[model samples]
Target: MLPLLLLLPLLWGGSLQEYPGYKLQIPELVTVQEGLCVIVFCEFFYPWHVSFTTDQLCIYWYWTGDNTYSNRLVATNCQNLVVKTETQGRFHLLGDPKTNNCSLSIRDARKSDTGIYEFRVWGQYVQYSYRTQLNLQVTDLTEKADIHILEPLQSGSPTNLTCSLPGSCDGGRPLTFSWMGDALNMLDPSTLQSSVLTLTPRPQDHGTYLTCQVKRRWPQVTTERTIRLNVSYPPQMLGSSCSWEAEGVHCSCFAQAWPAPFLHWWIGDRLVEGNSSDASFSVTSSSIGPWTKSSLSLSMELTSVLRLCCEAWNDHGNQSVTVLLLPGKSASRAEVALGALGGAGTMALLSLCLCLTFFFIVKARRKQAAERPGGMDDEDPVMGTVTWSCRQKPWPESTPAQQSHSGDTPPSREEQDVHYASLSFHGMKPQKSKDEEATSTTEYTEIKTSK
Candidate 1:
């Protein structure tokens, strides 16, 4: 009897939960997935020394949506106690009263099952009621994770992505995240995604799809997010050139790349004017294997001496080609002007000398005719020279003066030029006005001088 009396106190007494004399052993939080089962561990203390039996004791489990700690009846062993229709078969008694356990079991849990669950004991135990509460959360796993990244991913650079369960599941089991379905092997294994995934992208990896799967065994919930990658790579050299136009220079560069690259024309270090950093310039693109063939063009003002370059760039790198056009002209206009002037002056002087010779011969002819036959008026002529007008002709340049055949005697009249003039000229003359015979000789009086 003494031993029984002492053990009775140990049956239900010392407690840190609920009222000072009562104690309860229930986890403060519990989590489970919808259509799954959840067990809440529970044990409570009562005044065993007073008196109690299976028939005299009763246990009740109540739930409340209000966080204010008010009780709403759900399931109970008390006679005529009301149980919510929704929690009918869902709530079960997984514990026995003989072991002082008030644990509750819930099967086929739903999202609406989240709330504060409390335990109540009634019957003969010297108390009005003994109670304690635990928060329970139920999840359905309907929402998917979010993925964010640069629209067009850059190659050779690290990119980060994240995937996590929403905040709705209060006390769910530990979640794990993993990568799947990346045949290119571009995803970094060292970089995991409990909520985060990081990787260095490559050009060849463009159009690859990656999946992030999250799993939680407590509720057996699994969620996933799939992402398609568009990797950007710098331009690869195909061809480039800078050629001269009539009034300007035309430059072009062709390359192969992913995520089409930007191209521009440069003269030394400066970007070409009128052809700037905008898409206003010409561009042609075609899809190849894993890349795009892009061609770009720019036109800028021409310079006497030109050093031109064409450059192409993208997220990854850049390529360039240079062309140099040295300074100088193929032919000069100054020399043509000098040759034309010299030809005009020589023809003018030759005409002046011919007029003087004709005047002297006419005077001599009057004397001979007067001395021979018919009459004539004898007169001395004035020195006023009559300059004959001559039309411009398409003539070739003059040849060197012919040497005096018999140096002592005067040359024949048809021998051409009578005297020399100090005419200064240089270079070949301009072409004639038309394609006529420019070298035709002119007629002059023949002179036979008696030796």
Candidate 2:
């Protein structure tokens, strides 16, 4: 772009300062941002009889004063005149004094350079300094770089972005351009240092920041502009997962795209939307930035297997994934049957063991009774006592003989021998009373005889 200094003379006429034999025209005031450039439009006139040639005429622009020794000589046309070290290259005498134009150009302006400036002209025997002074004001830079996108960024599509400062010129201080932000990491490193950058955007770059920074080399001033990229892309499936929990099937889906896609689920042939439920399945969905996620749960009895489909879409395109979910009831039934068989087998085994224990106990009791001697009374455990009794045999033969002859005779009675015995048993010894003997003695034995 052309510098603003080239157009100053055509746009604005300078203030006129005239005298008896000399006239000068230059702007009364000029303002510029720091690290920028400006031009002072000037014109001067003299009587046509005052002759001068191009070789003899010289122009000088000074800072603050007209004396070359006291003031800073910033720009001059004299071959031997040396400009100030600070403004040597940046200050230039753009207008020719032979044509009566004393215009001045200043570049890479600094705040310290703000002051009044005077213009002067010299010839073989003539020298003059204009009474009209030019006021130059250099203020803090408050301008920023402009960013222009050639086209809307799309995933996998190449595009260009240009950065330029409003008042910058190629003739002024050389500017350094740089791009920054998360989105720039995906671009070529060589392309990041130029005023124009070319890049192919991706879905990951959407909503990320891109910054254009402009740096002026002389003053080291930096200005930047940041923009968020709205990269459009088709829906991309990030992940899908499913699980069985609490006799139900739960599934989740994740996807990314521009314009925040809408999410839907298809259970078998039924379609489900956000927070919507049917007789068989329920769905919940949410969208944040360019990513959309959804969850689905099936609570119905599944006697047959079904397919769960998760789909996402937007203005760009669509993406979907399907997963097969086996019937929940089928697995549960098999597990339940195995558990029932195990429980019944355990109960049967317990009953058999109890029966065997009871039979063994009864047989042991019978064997103990059979082993005891006849007519011997065993002591009762609860009472701790024993009793024994004996009786004689009856006369069987006499009774049969008497049955034939003793119809009229009265029967006679006869006594038979009978014996009785007693025994005592104690599980523990008892203390003797004071009246009892010290030595242990048998207390009693009862016996009876009958014939």
Candidate 3:
């Protein structure tokens, strides 16, 4: 960059003042940095015939005080002050007197040097004093712009960032504003001398450094200010899907959020174990984005169902997705449906057997009632009722009586083998009481044989 002092003429040409008779012109305003050099651009004219040799022409520059000129001589063409005094190293008159250029340059300007300065012309025994006030502010380059955020910044939302220059530094000379880092443009973002940058920041823009610069030609000042943006965003799915990894059944979940989202995995109804051999997993984190993404994979047994789930969350919000490899399948699900059906079938079979047994018992009672003598009524027989055809027992005959009574033989073998019983139906009457009925439910018979 060219020195500010060297550009003073070209930089502030439009503002240089001119006069009538002699036409002494110089920059109307100028400022020099402390410990730096500055130039007061000067040009003057006279009638061509009314020229003076170098000896007859003399040029002197003086510092007029802020309130009044104290005759403080800054530099003169006199060989002594130009080579001997403090002006030897600090001040110079670069413009030649014979050439009618009386530009004065100062080095190492100080705050006390802030005020008006003028050129004293001496030519052909005629001296002219053209007084012009140029306030020189010698300040360090440490002045910085103030950065302010108009509102809280949110991810995917527009925000206004204002860089206000020092209130004391605003000059009629428009201060050029610029941006250096983390911006879409280097030019001023606003119409004013300061800038108001409006942009919609993303989660990726958090912690991004933004630098603003303000430079003024007349003041010869440059100030830079930096600020970091903080952007907040909600958790969201990065890839929005999951699948088995190359090596094992691992699922990776991706999310974007501020302050990094917390992550966990769920399979079936149980929380998944991390970093274990049989379907264990792990979580990795990085600062590439504001959000966090987690991946979980469990080694599934051959009989294991292929359902996976992942949850990504933070203070703002949480999101989850379940990945199902096979339809209607999950880890550790029981076959309850098949078992329920089998139970129902077994109960039905037992009910059928009970019904058959009841039918057989009822049929047997009906048959016994039909076979009974005395021809029972068609009405349902009483369960304890009994009927018999034979009456009481018969008396035995004497041996001699049996031979005379016409017995061809004593008895046949079959007759001898026959058994006799004496039974009385009258004595065996039906009992209606519960105890007697229970006892009589079985049939009873009496028999006597020869033996």
Candidate 4:
């Protein structure tokens, strides 16, 4: 029972002892931008009976190991440290001892104000003490903000953007900058004095804007400069040599210009429209210069003959050139040459066909005549032999009446009857006897004598 009594007293004594002294809490480091405000807070604890009195409270603020009066009197209860004559208008000491709240405020800060601050507090009786370390980081708001270029104004040209902010600030303060567009951040902190952004100009970059934001130890402040990029190039002239030979209805017009330009074609008094044909254009840039030259070609087919006009225009400006084309003279020459060639070729073909036809017709007629029967006489003996026989009737033996009347005297009826009988026998059949042969010879001889 005695031991229990002793233990209870010991426990009561432990509980009755004063809690630990109030301790000021200070962050290892604090960052603030110029022309801004920051708060440094201090915390502590005290017994309930010890009421906070101005006489009992003595608080002092100073730099580390500061011996000069100028460094020692940042704040003191003996002399009221009013807002006037303070480094910053917002600087002040605020606390509620009942709640153990102690804090400091700084306003309109500057880069030179960056330093470590020490707070010392003393209380009556126990004479409690607390110390806190403060690191003030001073940065420039202007330094924390930046500028960036979004795009370039020329197509196919190299362009650069810049993100720039004021760089004159406390060296200990760090800054970060970035871009807010299609371009990736490629700036190296070591090489960059402040911040910058860049990109190459392209056709896709037109009508786009770029922005820049900067971040530092303080709350981020942004300043943006927008750039509207318009990628433009020279107009392209398309077509072949400007000459009169290329005159006709709906002549082909073409121009190959990038960043497409307005195109038009004209012939004589007519404004030829919708007669443009596909044209090829090319642009080449000098590697060392800012200018690029472009060539364009277009073909226009038209019916009229006059000066051919080609005009190309863009946002930059307009360019046009005219070529005189005498359709009558040029067309006539071309037509004559073509017609002569065609007629010559046709006539040569016709002559050749006619000659061939004539030769074939003559050959065919001769072949048909040769093949016809009874068309040619068979007279030449060298080719084949042919025998022919002729039959003759012997003259009738001289009438016997006539022979008897050879001397001019008249023969009687008996002579006439003998002549008739001989004539009748000859008509029937003549005998091939020696008397007949001799009588035939006598008749032949008498006829020769009569002749």
Candidate 5:
């Protein structure tokens, strides 16, 4: 009995009421896609071996904005609440008493199910409540699928395509349908229906892939389907076929398939990736019945000789054709001749400019020489000589012969005088006493002459 007493406290510690009641927890705030399930956790403070049941617990779900419960009640403890028509077969309530967990599973979820959910727990001696909100997001599978083009139809004919759900449609508002591609929403479908997109046969409409998508507005459901178009038409090359005028070495492949076909370019056995210099494609479809054609163009940076391969493909298969860009004998010879002519013409133009520049430079030098003083000799007929006199020194004594020509040719005389004066001015002076008597006699003679 004393041992039992000692163990009493231990037993009580291990018992269910050791702590407060069970607390529910839910970490997930949102879920996506229809028929997806969500779990709400219920944890107890004390570890207890309790029987799991939802008999006394009530769970209710409502959208965030509405005061009343959402149209759909996924699960309830009483099983009396009416299940929403959309969620009828999609939801379940699971409970684990030992773990105190009450979780809800929603099958084929819808956008309408997105909202907050409330849970209420009521027992004989304990009444506890907790709430966890679920943000349900539903996405349509159609939105994720790929759209492609199919080929092999007559050129210049109409083509038709069907876009349907790729997989099973889990019961919900069937996804709404829409189509887009080169036509840019040519077929505007307001509701969810199998859409048939049609285009006329034209070379430009050849390789485009039209896409069809299915989407639901509420509980966002989506699905997708795609079909390639094959509008058979004889291949027509865009731009020019002549090799000399070819803009680039690469070209685009196109076919008018009922659905748009895949376009590709090939050189011999190698595939060509189209770029600015290569051929590319754009597609458009006619509004009338099943005829579509695609235009294929090849471009190259004017090569002398080349061979090109063009191919188009779809899910059914692919078709290829080869075109030989052989230069015509005359055309090839003409191109070579023209290339030589162009080079010669360029060289001639450069030579002419150089010659003109040299001529102008010589003319300018001659004109400058003519304009510069004393730059030319007296004998040079191209320029006239100008004489410059030195003002700082006296003129030299000119010889008799030079003096006779001095007045006629002032420059030569001035030069001779400059040399004589430069030499004589250094040491020459007047004679003294004998000059005095001579001076007096000369003065008397000058006075008599003045009278």
Candidate 6:
């Protein structure tokens, strides 16, 4: 009866003190990704006892359903106790129970480690367990590594890039880091396995993928981050070529740069804009990726001299090149030598036709004047003139005295009035015209008339 009375008070006081000051301050749930880490902050309180000392406090974290001594323990501050083989180094008791701190730190968490956990405190003449439990949920690792660039990537300049995984701590399974990308192909092979990379960017590296991969050896977990590089660079002229197409010169110029450089066609100091057309020149431009191509087609006269230039520029810098649009006329060239030649030939042919027309007109007028009446003055002269009279008024019978002397009979008065006259005509051949033949003639005539 005496031993029964002594145990009753102890049992009654334990039950009454359980809910008053004994409590655990900790989150009810904790979530962590596999192969990552987490920290569970905790603090505990209990009724003070005269025989208990802070130095003798021992904290135990149990993984099994029951807190019995036979169950496996994940973490404990007592040096003589043993921890589970699976969580030997992974689970840590970071806080000292002497300060009422019962914090737990987990590293390289595994999926099998998900379960309810309880905190127990033991000391001389006192032993207690918090009814509040911590539930851990470890799911698939869906997080990726982070890549940080120190500054904007510029061509020909060295830059640093850092890679790190989120929720990773100093004391955990060592992670292996590696870099993968087209831009890293030219670098030393040994440098690709480091967490930090030194990169010298170029114009060709723009828009190329750069990947940072992180791997955990213990759990064989992998995570990666990919980013496209943006490298700023000056414009670089690739090449320029020209060909005669139909009636104009088709010229193409190529340039490459970051930020898609603006292309322009220059004739001396004039700026040729997009799809511009005039009497002598036309231009068109387009871009794809980092390359820009500009085309110029122009028809100019043969006598004209033109100098064609292709210029490209961006925020970084500028580039330019002079293009030859013709073969032999490279000294002072036009867009199309063939077009210019064709134009010159047409003008020459028209001039020739006009000259022939004028020549024929002069010859026709001279021929018509020669056929008219007074056009012969330079080729023919006038001949002698002859005069003749048909009427004879009594030649006076050869003068009446002459008739008497010649023993001519002078008839009566009427016969003497009717005198006879003789006239003679001599014809000389006149100058023949172009189409006629010359002739000669002579004739004599006798007439008698009464006055």
lDDT of 1 by residue, 1-451 (tens): 7565444434543543345456778888898766556777788886563344445567887787766366677777665777888788667776666677777877766778889876766654434344457888986656675666634467767777667655433233467787765633654565655566666776556788978887766557788888887776666545444433333334444555565655555554456432334433444444555433434343443233344454555556655444443333222346434543655565566657657866787787666656753332322222111111112222223433434344456666756534432211122121111111111111111110110
lDDT (Cα atoms) of all candidates against the true structure: 0.54, 0.66, 0.53, 0.44, 0.42, 0.69
Cα deviation at 332, candidate 1, in Å, is 21
Full candidate order by TM-score, most accurate first: 6, 2, 3, 1, 5, 4
User: Per-residue lDDT for 198-315 in model 2, tens only?
Assistant: 9788777888899999988655778999999989887766666665566566787777777887888777666677789777677888888777889988777655445566777777
Candidate 2 displacement at residue 398 in angstroms? 99
Runs in model 5 lying further than 4 Å from the true structure: 1-21, 27-46, 51-74, 77-91, 94-101, 105-116, 121-127, 131-192, 195-451
Worst ten-residue run, lDDT, model 2? 385-394
On lDDT, the leading prediction is 6
lDDT of 5 by residue, 268-296 (tens): 34554433232432222221232223233
Badly placed stretches (over 4 Å) of model 3 are 1-138, 167-174, 180-194, 240-248, 269-293, 300-307, 327-451
RMSD of 2: 36.5
lDDT tens per residue, model 4, 1-451: 6455333423443342323443456676888767556777776554323463544566666654332234534554435553234453345667754355567767656666777676555554224334345677877564334454455355544556666544423332355665554422343434334365445554445556655655545544555444555555544333323322343223222333335655555444445433333432112211112222222232443333234454555554444444433322234456756755766765566557657965886677566657756634332211111111011122235656477679976766554532000000111111111101011101100000000
Q: What is the lDDT of residue 157 in candidate 4?
A: 49
Best by TM-score: 6
Q: Write down the TM-score of every candidate.
A: 0.36, 0.49, 0.37, 0.28, 0.30, 0.54
Question: For each candidate, C-alpha RMSD in Å?
Answer: 30.5, 36.5, 36.3, 46.1, 37.3, 38.4
Off by over 4 Å in 1: 1-139, 148-154, 168-171, 174-176, 181-196, 204-208, 218-221, 230-250, 255-262, 268-270, 273-306, 313-318, 324-451
Cα lDDT of candidate 2 equals: 0.66
Candidate 2: where is the Cα deviation over 4 Å? 1-30, 38-135, 142-146, 180-188, 207-211, 222-229, 327-451
The TM-score of candidate 2 is: 0.49
Model 2 / residue 39 / CA error / Å = 8.4
